[model samples]
Structure formats: C-alpha cells, structure tokens
Target chain A: MPYGYIASMKARPGHRDEVIDILTGGADGLRTAGCHLYVVAAATTDDVTIWVSEVWESKQHHDDSLKLPEARAAIAQAMPLLTGEFFTQETEVRGGLTGQP
Target chain B: MPYGYIASMKARPGHRDEVIDILTGGADGLRTAGCHLYVVAAATTDDVTIWVSEVWESKQHHDDSLKLPEARAAIAQAMPLLTGEFFTQETEVRGGLTGQP
Candidate 1:
C-alpha cells in the first residue's frame, strides 16, 4: 500500500484565502511531481488553519516530489503566510490488514 | 500492535506552555484510561504549535479515554487557548509490516 504524509499548517490572520489559492495552484504541480493524493480542509470554526492530508505511491515518490522545481518554488510562496508551524510525519499504511480496505 | 492517534494543536500566542501543561497533566489520566503512550513535542521553529503523538493499546482504549471525566474537563480548560484547528487521526501501526519493527 502507498504511505501517507499528513501536514497541518495555519495561515497568518487575513491570509488564509491567499494561502489556499496558492495551495490550489499546486494541485497540478503535486500530481505531475508524483503526489498520489492531496486534500486540504479548513477548520470548521477556524478558517486560518488547514489540514493537508497527502499521499504518495511510496516514500521515494514523496522525496522525489520535494525536489521538484515547482514544489520547491510553490512552497517558498506559501511558507511566509504561515503564522505558526506545521507537523508532518511519514506514515506506513496498515489499512489493508485493518480491514478498512 | 497498538494504534496511534496524532493530534496537532496550535495555541494562541503566549499560551503554548499552558497547553502543554494541561496535556502533561493528562498523562496519568490517559494511562489509567488505557492509553499506552502520549508524547508532546513543541515545534522547534514555532512556539505556538505542538504536536501530540499518542498510542493506545487498541482503538477501544483511545475511545475510552475520550469519555474519561478528567479528559473531558482538561479539554475544556485547554480549548480556549487554541487559536486555530487541530488535526486528529486514528491510525493503525503498520510498522511491523513495513519492516520498521
């Protein structure tokens, strides 16, 4: 199964929409660069923060995407709007044996 | 193997330590309620965001902790200091299958 990487980030006050726009633009950037899936959800009560749940075919695919030109440049554009920091983990999927699949 | 629940919270400015304190207090409360482990890490770069990585012996253990009176009460005290949303996930450990164990 493909591994998953979840990254959660919060935007600076008044900059959430711009951040989302930039993230939206990265859809294609992510796909072409090797991302298998990427989903972003704004907090129901707090719009400034967004949780990005992403997946790649494998750890190698994820690492490869980070070095992609578009991914790096897009990250540069989005990093400043963040007020705090982000948490990310490289997780192995046990979804199959768990019977969820 | 145990399951893990990762919760990432961003505290309001100046409230990070307070939040961590609340969480720390939950350590005993969690273990008694069936948690196997609970660890909190303050972001190295952002003082306001903290990532809490927790493990329960099983899914039932995690669910039971939520209903613990201490757990509920502690959340009430800590919720207000949060400036944005939190991301929580219940995940199975595929470490064994992934050759990490």
Candidate 2:
C-alpha cells in the first residue's frame, strides 16, 4: 500500500504566503524522490494555517525525500516563517481517484 | 482555485472497514459530479480512524455531490458504523502534483 499523510502548519502572523511559496517550491524534487502526490493548501477560513496532503510510494521514500538537499533547504526557509504549530496524521493509502488512472 | 478538504472520522469499534467500503464505493458518482480527487485512507497507528482527502473543481461541485442520491445513500449506510467523531479542514487547493497534468 502507498504511504500518505495530511499535515497542517501555522505560519507566523504575517508570513503565510511566504511559507506556502517555500513549501510548494520543492515539488519537482519531491516527485523525483518518489512522491505520488504533494498538494499544498490553505484553509478557506483561516489565514495562518496551511495544509499539505501527500502520498508517497512508501514510508521510506517519504523519509528519504526529507533528506534531499532541496527539501532540507525549503524546510529551513519555511520554518522561520511558521509558528511551530503542527498537526499530522499518517495513513495507509486505501483506494480512490487520485487522477492517476 | 480548487476546493479541497481533509476529513477524519472515527468508525465504531471494528466497523472501520465497512465504513471505508461505503465511502470509497461512491467514487464513480462523485467523479461524474465534478470531483477531481477522492482518496480514502486509514491512519497506520489508529485502526478505527479513517481519513478522506478530497479536491473538487469548485466548492459548488463539492456541495452538489453531497446531494446526489448515491452519495446520500453511502453516507446513510456509513453513519451507523461511525462513532460521530469528525474533523474537517476546508482548503483552497494551491498547487502540486495530483497525478494530473
């Protein structure tokens, strides 16, 4: 089964857009590192929170991607803009439309 | 921008699979109703909790889907199997790979 997770983070008071930019900037590298899905989203009703929904080929693939140079750099840049509040739910990809058909 | 959300629900003890089945079974109808993505997943460390990550063409599309007969039926069937615990975060789909062009 594929590995997946939905993670949410809060950006510093006025830096949500900057944080989102950095988070989304590493997608190409993530795809090459075995990510099947990497979606960055922001709550419609909340300005400081951002949600990332990801599907990786495996848990190991996800872990390895975090070690990639670009990934680490992006994370470092975004971390300063974030509030340190986070939420994550690790999941086993069951099944449904992923637009992969 | 696309409309999306990550919703988590807790199934009644031992009824998680049944709920997942019903939730995933409505995919065909949802696609036709303008859903871009609908992924059913279960937390690896929590057997009774199920997470559904979805992206629709628009918020209207998502709202319309819930009124579909098939969707209503599936919800009705799954509700009894659920514990009524739910978490929902509505989002504005920013961007990334969704396995779509």
Model 2 interface CAPRI class: medium
Which 10-residue window of candidate 1 chain B scores lowest in summed lDDT? B92-101
Candidate 2 - chain A - TM: 0.95
Where model 1 places Cα greater than 4 Å from the true spot, the runs are: A1-101, B96-101
Model 2 Cα lDDT, one tens digit per residue, A1-101: 99998899999888998888888877766777888888899988878999999999999999998888888888888888888999988999888888744
Tens-place lDDT digits, model 2, residues B1-101: 99997899999989998888888886866777888888899998878999999999999999988888888888899998999989998999888788744
Cα lDDT tens digits, model 1, B1-101, are 56666677889999988887887775755655666445555654566877665556788888877787888988899999998788676554322111111
Give candidate 2 misplaced runs (Cα > 4 Å): none
TM-score of chain A of 1: 0.83
**A13-80 in candidate 1: lDDT tens per residue?**
99877777777676755665556555454544466776555555677888888787877887899899
User: Which has the greatest DockQ?
Assistant: 2
